[model samples]
Target: MSASTPIARSKSAALARILDNVPKGYHRYTCGTVAARKAEALAQKFHTLYGIGCSPAQRLIRKGKGLANVVLVMHWPVDAEKVEWLLLATDGKGLETETLRDVGDKQRLKWLGYELARHTNRAKVMWTWRRTKEEMTELHALIAMQANQHNTAAISETLERIARQPGFRGVRTQSWALCEAALQRGYDGPLPHLYFVQKTNHGERLALD
Candidate 1:
């Protein structure tokens, strides 16, 4: 039987071990608006330290846990639609966490870990579709490299770029729409400012001037 939660020294570190097994395709959508820069920054740190492409979408861990906990907010890579936000957490053990948001027909976290499957509750039906690996790879390369080169003014150009992809079929889901919005939301800081905080010992975001 899997433990109810993680029991690793660092939740982020433990999660890195499970990301490869989450069953997501190439990570194309990364980087978010000013509101999400903190998460993106932390996601880069996780990638650097653990090699798993993860970002914190929502970091609302209540106060008081004798253990280190990290909530990684992200979308399932396999789902090209990006309909829902997948919240993954880590603990003192392995990758054990509860999904924060599930707004789609299928719950794809079965690959995260057994503990997560049990804890993942609620699923709101949303857009569903299938995408090719080539599409995903192209999007990732285009968006990631020019992440800071988009804004409300360049929305047309950005959309055009995505639409011009080899097999671009167009956005089919609200999740994909939201993901596009984030891409064009523009960068708030010169560089991403990662935030690592606990309710008890909450810390300010690390933004370079």
Candidate 2:
């Protein structure tokens, strides 16, 4: 087929749009349709490239496809946050990593007709199926805090950033709503900046690094 063919041009345009949708500057797990390969084959690819026991987990990517879901071609070991942080801290576009940053070799090969192993710094699955009120409340807090992170720069800028994040519109929470209201009103009192407020043991003293 010639490069100028209609199908070729259409594919090129579609691929370009996919790349554009990808968050820039962050390392991405190049995902493919779940029907593309067997679990063993997918895991083997990562093992071959990264090292022994370096199996990547499958991630469901929900976007663009009307009723269809997508899964990873071969998940990369590093998560977007780790990649961004490593790049920023090292001041380089790429960074090195030791083998299996999180676990040993793949085990329990299969209990469900598939083996999905991952030792990546990937975030917890979003499980966008649904959320309870409490879960939604937590999401709002997380959103507000994420917006105010140093990476976010300013409040107004963070608001804009929050607006751009997907899967948040469905969440409804009074606390998050309050935070949003305060943020919109320019009331920047105290923000929920900590990821988890660790509760120390009763007799244990907190240690400062």
lDDT of each: 0.32, 0.28
Ten-residue region with minimum lDDT total, candidate 2? 82-91
Q: In candidate 2, what are the lDDT values of residues 101-151, reduced to their tens digit?
A: 211123311111122232222663211111344545555565556555633
Q: lDDT winner among the candidates?
A: 1
Off by over 4 Å in 1: 1-129, 149-155, 161-171, 174-181, 184-209
What lDDT score goes with residue 14 in model 1?
32
Clashing pairs in model 2? 32-73
**Residue 49 in candidate 1 has what lDDT?**
39
RMSD of each: 17.9, 20.1
- How would you encode candidate 1's per-residue C-alpha lDDT over 1-209 as one tens digit per residue? 21112222332333333333233321211222222434444445543432233222211221123222333334322223321223333333222332232322254322222122212215632211223344555655555455556443344444555443222112223225534544455533222222221222112222211
**How many backbone clashes are present in model 2?**
1
| Per-prediction TM-score to the true structure, in the order listed | 0.20, 0.21
